[model samples]
Target: MKRIIPFILALLLLAACGAEPVEAEASPPPPMPTASPLPDYIPPMDFEPVSVWQAEHFSGRALLYLGAEEDGVTPFKVYSCFMYEVTDYLDGNMLMGARAFCAEAADSGDFSVDCSNRGLWLEPVLGASALTGKLSVDGDRLTLEYTGCELAAWAEDTPGFEYRLSGGQPVIDSGTGENDSVQYLPTEFKRLPDEYLGRAMYWMPMFEEEASASAESVRGLRVGDTYADIVARFPNPLDIWSRDPRSVSAPDGWYDTFYGSEAGTVFAALFYEGGVPSTVLITCCSYASFQLDGGLNITQLSVSAR
Candidate 1:
């Protein structure tokens, strides 16, 4: 329905809770604060980072920032459309939002970066997306001048997107979902010399797409995982917060809840129907909800329980 927060900002909000060690090393739940800013805790990335960047000073304008070189990481701050979210990033649709994972350089010293992986819980939302625009750095200035988005294939098996079905067909809203404003066009960045990963922002900044298949789980818990597994993994009560289920996105017997239980988390919710996890709701991926011709459920993926 109405948006409480931006798609995945919830993960940014829960940047701490989801990272707690499982049962054995689990500690007692701390006093639940009413509010908290983002935290500083960088875990080892499962994938190699091409150009790791976190926005040092968000201009709140169109300007981008680049971080200085340190501990094998660099913050290549790129501009995402401020008005709207990126579409189907994990479903193979990328935009300027895709984190730079590929690097290429020519004899003239111009460089380009291909971003594949994002930070935080979204680290798994990666694939070859069409909107993988490179930051062409000609000498000192860097610019993302690519403007392209893939047509929504409306495929049945998108792990990182969701579509609502009406009469077995998607209710297509007619119009271009693109932002024609100049602010959304190609942008430039001013390089900065600082390490703000753990200081300025809580985690690595990243954005995603609209194809569907639930890609988020608490403590790496996945679909088909047992309730015992959830309990064992998150022994702390506050680790996952059970919430009231809504008929719009819920299934039978399953009550609704979220992976992160802090103030700003609504991105990823878990559905338990008295057994193993039956469904997972990733509200953070897509922008406008698309109507699908065939039926689509709230991202029931078969991710490994192992």
Candidate 2:
């Protein structure tokens, strides 16, 4: 009787276990492709080929680096920083998905790590800020070597602030499927209206100028002021806008709007001071430039024609 009871319990256990799909077989994933060897020093250094090799085995994320160390070594923490994917659009400033930077080794046992211009680039962050220094990855340490130089991307003025000239660059990933490269989160595009999407670029809804919050004003600052005068008064509001943490990027770089917009022939140049648009207009040039953000430059452009 005891033997019979044990046999019944064993059958019950097998029945509770889910059955596997015997009919359909799972296929194995394809192996990653390998990159070719690098040559001796070249004038315009190319980092793409080496980037491919680094992506294969990179397993860290949101890497943290130590502050400017006299020693070349910078400490890092793993947190998954495969950020920044570039998406192609017709014109103006595009979104900031950005490519992830990767690391690699050279032939003859020489090792080198360089920033990834495309694909899963391991982003190196220090504390809360992204390091702008020349970036590279090796083992658990991420190295940032600053040579004090600004290489104009492709000799064709960088597309816009924080944008790199991706044209004339090597193709790394197809960017489809799980491994294939594609545009930035298409979901944002899907939700946008057709008209808004059709245009290469347009001003995003920033804020309607507030009637108040501006306490004091600089004397002689007014509409129809020369662009030079505005610069003189503020020591370059555009530059201030670029560096200001509170400020957001306009499609064209420094200023908020391009030459002309809803404000008729008058152009708007935004420089924010504590999130308030300065109320001064820059005139005398073909385009009307004015501060759309802050306490000096005027935000108000158009008035009822008398």
Candidate 2 wrong stretches, greater than 4 Å = 1-93, 100-168, 173-306
lDDT of 1 by residue, 1-306 (tens): 346566467777688677877567745333222212323322233332233232222212232444443554434434332222223223322222222222332333233343233433232212222233345554545654433332233322433333222222221111222211012222455433344433322122212322222235333344434333333322123544322222234355554433322122113345445333444443333311211111112233332211
RMSD (CA, Å), each prediction? 21.6, 29.5
How does model 1 fare in lDDT? 0.32
Instruction: Name the best candidate (by TM-score).
Output: 1
